[model samples]
Structure formats: structure tokens, C-alpha cells
Target: MENKEIILNILHEIKNGNIPVHTDYNLNLDMWADLIEYMHDRTYIADVTIYWFGDDDTYNDERVHSVNLTKVRLTTFGERFLTEEMN
Candidate 1:
């Protein structure tokens, strides 16, 4: 799915009280992480936890091996954005 669609779905799920919205299995982990980071950075979402490996000294890898979103919730701005997008 497109980023906009995924974002909308995520915001909608959060608005509906879904704590952690799971994406389609086919979606790339990196892309998902980027989207979550983007939203969080922009204050569109809050209370998020992201887990990753292979980017630290313990992993000794330059590339990130896995990215998991353990928690997420929509912010007021996110709700407004979702509402606007839906119209």
C-alpha cells in the first residue's frame, strides 16, 4: 500500500484505541520504521517504542537487521490529519 494509505490506517487504528497497529506482512520493516519515525518526529503520533538490532556495537553491523514497532498511538494532530485526509 501507499505510504499515505498506511499512515491513515495507522492513525485510524490508534484513534479507535488500537495500541499497536500491525502492518501487512509484505511491508518492508525499514519502510515501516521510517514511516513511524517520520510521524513521531512530526508529532503526529506519540507513545511509541521502536526496537531494532544490527545497528549497534553489540551487533557489529552497519545495517539494521530488524525494526519492530512495539507501541504507538495517535496524537491530536494525527487525528486532525486523519480527519482531513478522509474528507
Candidate 2:
């Protein structure tokens, strides 16, 4: 799938509780490195805060090598986008 579609699918899955919520969400770097930043940039332009990157400490941890640790959740605008525009 295209990067945009993949990102929307990821967000949709999170909204549906298919992906974990509130807690730190682990990403597959091979899949994330190139696309996630693009997705997040779109979300920023949309004026909705849907994700928060973990702090430096978490990012620097040795356990996780390539995968980024982030917290993902739907905001009010995000929910609306999921239900209205995306569908």
C-alpha cells in the first residue's frame, strides 16, 4: 500500500483498538522511518495532535534499536477525520 494509505490504516487500527492505546506504541522502523514523519507532518497540518514521540531517554534506550517508541491516540479532530473524511 502507499505510505498515506498505510498511515491511515495504522491510525484507523488504533482508533478501533486493534492497536494498543495510551501506552507506548512500538513501530517497525523499516516501515516507519520513511513514512511516519510524513504522516505526522500531515496530522500537524490538519491541526490535530494524534501522536507524541517519546522523550530522549526512551529514544536512547539500548533495548530498541531501530524502532521508534511513540504514544498514539485519536484526538477529537482525528476521530472526526476517521469517521468523515477517511470513509
Candidate 3:
């Protein structure tokens, strides 16, 4: 699926109380970063973090920001985005 679709799917799942888990370290990391940024920028999702751990040994790439999808949930705007804009 496309990145947009994937993001919506993740949000839908989150809205329905499903937790998405990835065994791989880099599972959709780039896409997650973008989604996190987009949602935060638009105030769609709150209390979610897109952060660099600042530990080079753990996250070798300084450019890579980490997002824990399981720790994030859909905000009111995010729900509206999914139902109104994404449906």
C-alpha cells in the first residue's frame, strides 16, 4: 500500500485500539517519521514523539528520528482526518 494509505490504516487501527508492532528495527521508519511530522504539524496527533535519541551507538544515523507507534494514538483531529479526509 502507499504511504498515505499505510498511515491512514495505522491511524484507523489505533482508533480501534489495535497496536501495531514491528520486529524489525527499520520497519517503515522513514514513513513513520513523515507521518509523525505531518500529524504533529497539523495537530492531528498529540503526545506522540518524533525524536532522535542522541545516542550515536544506538541510532547510528544522526538524521534518523525514532517514533514508537505503539505509544501513539489518534487525536480528535486525527480521527476527523481519517473519517473525513481519508475515507
Looking at model 2, how many pairs of residues clash? Answer: 0
Give the lDDT of residue 68 in candidate 3.
65
Clashes of 1: 0
TM-score of each: 0.72, 0.46, 0.64
Worst lDDT window (10 residues) for model 1? 61-70
Q: RMSD of each candidate?
A: 3.0, 7.4, 4.4
What are the lDDT figures for the candidates, one per model? 0.71, 0.49, 0.66
**Candidate 1 residue-wise lDDT, 1-87, digit = tens:** 777888888788778876443445256666667778888998888876566665567775444345444456678898889999999
Instruction: Return the lDDT, model 3, position 40.
Output: 68
In angstroms, give how far residue 65 of model 3 lies from its true place.
Answer: 5.3
| Residue pairs with backbone overlap in model 1 | none
The digit string of per-residue lDDT tens for model 2 on 1-87 reads 554556667667767656422222344543454354455565621322233355356564323233332445566665766677586
Among the numbered candidates, top lDDT falls to 1
Q: RMSD (Cα, Å) of candidate 2?
A: 7.4
Prediction 3 global C-alpha lDDT: 0.66
